[model samples]
Target: MVHDILITKENPFENDVLNFRDHIHQFCSQFIFRKIPLSAVVGITGEWGTGKSTYLKMLQMHAEGKNKDVIYFNAWKYEFYEDPLIAIYFEMESKFKEVLTLKKYKKVLNDFKLYGTQFIKSVLINSISYVSEGIINLQDTKDNVKKIKEKQATLLEKRIEDLKGAKELVDRFSDSIATLAKIINENTDSPLIIIIDELDRCLPPHALKLLERIKHILSVPGVVFIIAYDKNQLSHSLKTLYGNDFNIEGYLIRIIDHEVAIPSLFSAEYFNKCADKVVLSNNIYIDKFDESYKGLNPFAVTNILMKLSLRDQQYIMHNIYSLNNKNKNITKISYLLVYFYFLGGLKLKNPSVFKLFESGTITKAEFYRKVLPALNPLERDEVIIGGAEILMAIVLTIISLIEGEQNPNNLTSLNLNGVNLEFNVHLVADVKTRMTTQRITNLKNIPKLYSEYPTFSLD
Candidate 1:
């Protein structure tokens, strides 16, 4: 499993949705992160499965590590209301009320009686969230299975009954939830770090409204709304919503003009670090990831690979020819070359795609063709130069999964048949709903093939 970070042969670091912090390290280190009282909104751009959420988390942790006040929220989730700005108002109200002492905390609560219903809700729901999400591995037990099952059955029945009453109580009190979040932030040592992911996944019209709302309101002090986005797709979504004339990047520029693009949150260097941490140093080699290929970006590499295997991607042109000589209006293969590097030794295990959840509006295929394209534009001209190179790096990252290179950072696995990670192929939408998807590119391969995508181990 790609879950463990230490004492595992397969790297867990790459899987750290929060590992992409290099982009903000400088700004954070120099200007606000360690030095000043700065309230800045750092945004990220990536398609749905490109792992923006994980990387944003890494950045937040990195900031918090440096002792900065960080607050984060996903606008797509927070801006579910009609005003959307209420999401903003809720944020402000929560922070202010939290500064009060126990006495103040109570007085603040009394003054916030209107939100009593919400406070109960926030606490009740979060009390459940207070549990660690790490899956517990049970040791083998040969005891009485039937009796254990009966006991668990009784416990669940009692718990469900208790929960039912609590939920009803909370449903009537939503405002207090906001107040609770504020109090929670106040007691924490670091800044309030709120990560709002899947911005580009919402309805086009609704998403645009939320974006505008964030621009106007989410900039409150002590809260650094770490927004995760895929700019290439987001702009397109905006076009669909506002108009063909709407310029999404331009609109984003007017407000969130500065964005921290994590070029290689999944870079070879980072993954290499992960491998060393998890596995015995003797089992891995230093030069396995081909250090010189650093300049190539990750996305560009994956893009070219996807295109090449697409039916061998032949090109044909028809033309009127001269006497007897066949005339083909074939232009130069420059565009193809422009897009590809030598298709070197490489193999990938696209993670098995599965329907995690579904709402009536969002389907599995629709998630990719519609949602994914915007969140992670697999094929597109990028604003940042060297996109092709960036993709080359990505190709190697794929190979890392296949051959188990740098398995320390983020362990990727594959069965003999391969894997395909997808989300909501079945669309069951739940509130606080996350896009149900898979990490699809987990891979595995032998040494000879491993040498193709990533460098071979020295050992």
Candidate 2:
């Protein structure tokens, strides 16, 4: 009989609760304790359902302990209709307004003499309209003067409508945060923190736009943005926008003045909390058996092992592959472990539960297929590459990135040496294709090996 591991902690990771606390503590210390608040832009990179949004929510809880006026937002499912920075600012102003009405913050609001309503309006309007004397006046319309007015009038009306709609949203956000910041600043005298969560699930294009928009967009200081993201997705995104010039390592450091990568290490105490909540509380495992979970990839091993009997625990734990593969030095098993860790975490949550059962216990296939190639799509876009399909599209885009965007016809067909292959091999090394296409002579003409096309992913 399968048993569900009960987790007592707030961890969304069904069974694995690791070193999230230290990460939160350290990140809070760096941003809150240090007053060096630059235009901090952080992108939380992770596969979808790595529980990044939950992690950010936890950070919001911790930030309160340090006297930061936290403004929390989930970009997923929201950034589609609205702009992110403007959305953030709107949230801030609203939070500020809310704080002003509180008895403790009322004095602060009065002292600053900040007319919350007006400040918010001006900020919103300023953000929306980039009107200059020349553009506003009849200056650049000498030739197409009549035509220019009609086009300009339509553009102006649309801009007005957009800004007006943004105004209502921003007004609410501004009122809440503006007053909140005023209150917090007045009451405790600390920098206000604005946390934007779920960049990975957010519209990637919108997220891409948000990164460009946030600098001048969120015109507030003393506001630290704790952006939670997974690096793999962030790199994938960076490659999409910046192309060959995408300097991911340098860019991450620059964007995040203070970056706190969810520490790779897992803590036993958090596990105790998890066991108390999920497994041990139900007496699924013996009291002493909890210690065996230590040193394993807290991301995967504990969750997988704890789900099975202690005997099965020994088997899964010993073979659990680490998903992280960027390091060339690590064993392939370790990297595969990272891959499985994420996939296992994924399975522990939702629909793919049966897939794990279908793949059989670890004894079935070890070398040929590391993790089961389920090819399942996640509900949330895989931050790793949005989702598999988006990732495929992005890979297609990058295929052209290596070969310039100018040519659209030959995209599907990759040439080996001088000639176009008999059939354009859209995707390669498909284990299914290997078996099916082995008999076909034309398969040799198509690109297959990673050695041939060094630029292809799997890097």
Candidate 3:
């Protein structure tokens, strides 16, 4: 039952071949504790589903062990709101409720609440007019003299100035932000680390607003922000929000102090480890297969795994484990199964070709032309491998089952392009003899192989 329950997500401490989690934690620690600048924005860049969020979780865990304050915020969770300032304000407030008693940080919390309300209101009411210089000719109408009326106008203008000058209003707003940052830093023992994840997942406006708000208004001395996203996506977002002429890289440079790319975690060693676990834990009899038949390019398989999420990885492994457990000789046909599962799972490639072939709607020549190239190319030295015969058997077995004829003897008699497929049929018969009816039925359904991994491609 080793494969019964796959690790749903990677553990922070689980070191892979790349030690990705450890490297992220180390970077966060070094950047946050720098002497000169107490506040910094660290950008963790990776394409979608490359596990940036998981790395942030590991960093949070490491920071917590050292008694540092960590605030994790998912921007996508509150993307429904028009204003990102509200999203950030509420997210911080929610986190504070869990960690610190409200009584101590009540004033600081209220400052955030008041400033957020005012900031939203200011954006909404964007056109406040300054006092005009024109004098009213109400000298005769008023009981007071003309000179007294003139003095009244000057006094009224001065009073209005005292109420709110444009510069004064902006300074007050900036002071409110500084107060909030100072109070939180002074109240907390360690520096506050804010991890903003899925920033790129937000809509173009929301993403740009969040970045702008963080860079301008919320930045403070004792706080550090780690923003996780795909740099390319965010750059595109900025261009969409701003014009095509926008200085995307320069704008990013102003916000992100240190940018680190998330490394590809699917090394050859890592995938081999995963394969060993799937095989041995499921009691799959892969050893009986000839070495050449079992051979596949690890690099190609690892590249396929890279395009998938951790969740997808777990799912495909579970399917393989279950299938191999049922059909003890499932490993014999795994060469094609691995490629077929991924191709069908992504569905970006041609899966219709397989369907046509299985239903006897396509010729063998058409199947070879359309489908074979999509599969991982075997090495030139391994041309004599029995994989081609096994592949043909797999196709014929499925074609027979889908046509309601599961008999191996009947399966071997299928004519492909006027040539007798006798040898391929025997290969199918040999493997089918070791499998149960249910196992063969499972293999008959090709979509079952694909249905588990989502058809959606991140690209």
Compute the lDDT of residue 357 as modeled in candidate 1.
16
**Greater-TM-score candidate between 2 and 3:** 3
The parts of candidate 1 lying over 4 Å away from their true place are 1-21, 30-39, 64-69, 76-194, 265-459
Q: Give lDDT tens digits, candidate 1, residues 1-459.
A: 112223111332344433444455664554344322234456776654455655555555565554444445566676556544456546545644544446656755664555543443444454453123212214425575666567567766766886785565444333343344355445553345555677776777767766664555345444455677778778778787677887766777776735776553333333333334422132322222233433233323333433322111111000001100221111121111211222221122121111111111223233234323322323333322233333322332333333333332232221111212221211112101211121322111111221223222211
Error of 1 at 397 (Å): 24
Error of 1 at 264 (Å): 3.8
Residue-level lDDT of model 3, residues 177-250, one tens digit each, is 55554555565544568899989988998888889888876676667888999878888888887888888789
Alpha-carbon RMSD of each model: 22.2, 17.4, 9.5
- lDDT by residue (317-398, candidate 2, tens digit) is 2222110122222122222223333333334343344243334322223211432333332223122111222222222322
Candidate lDDT values, in order: 0.40, 0.44, 0.58
| Sort order, lDDT high to low | 3, 2, 1
The candidate 3 region of ten consecutive residues with least summed lDDT is: 1-10
Report RMSD for candidate 1.
Answer: 22.2
Write down the TM-score of every candidate: 0.40, 0.47, 0.61
- The number of the candidate with the highest TM-score is 3
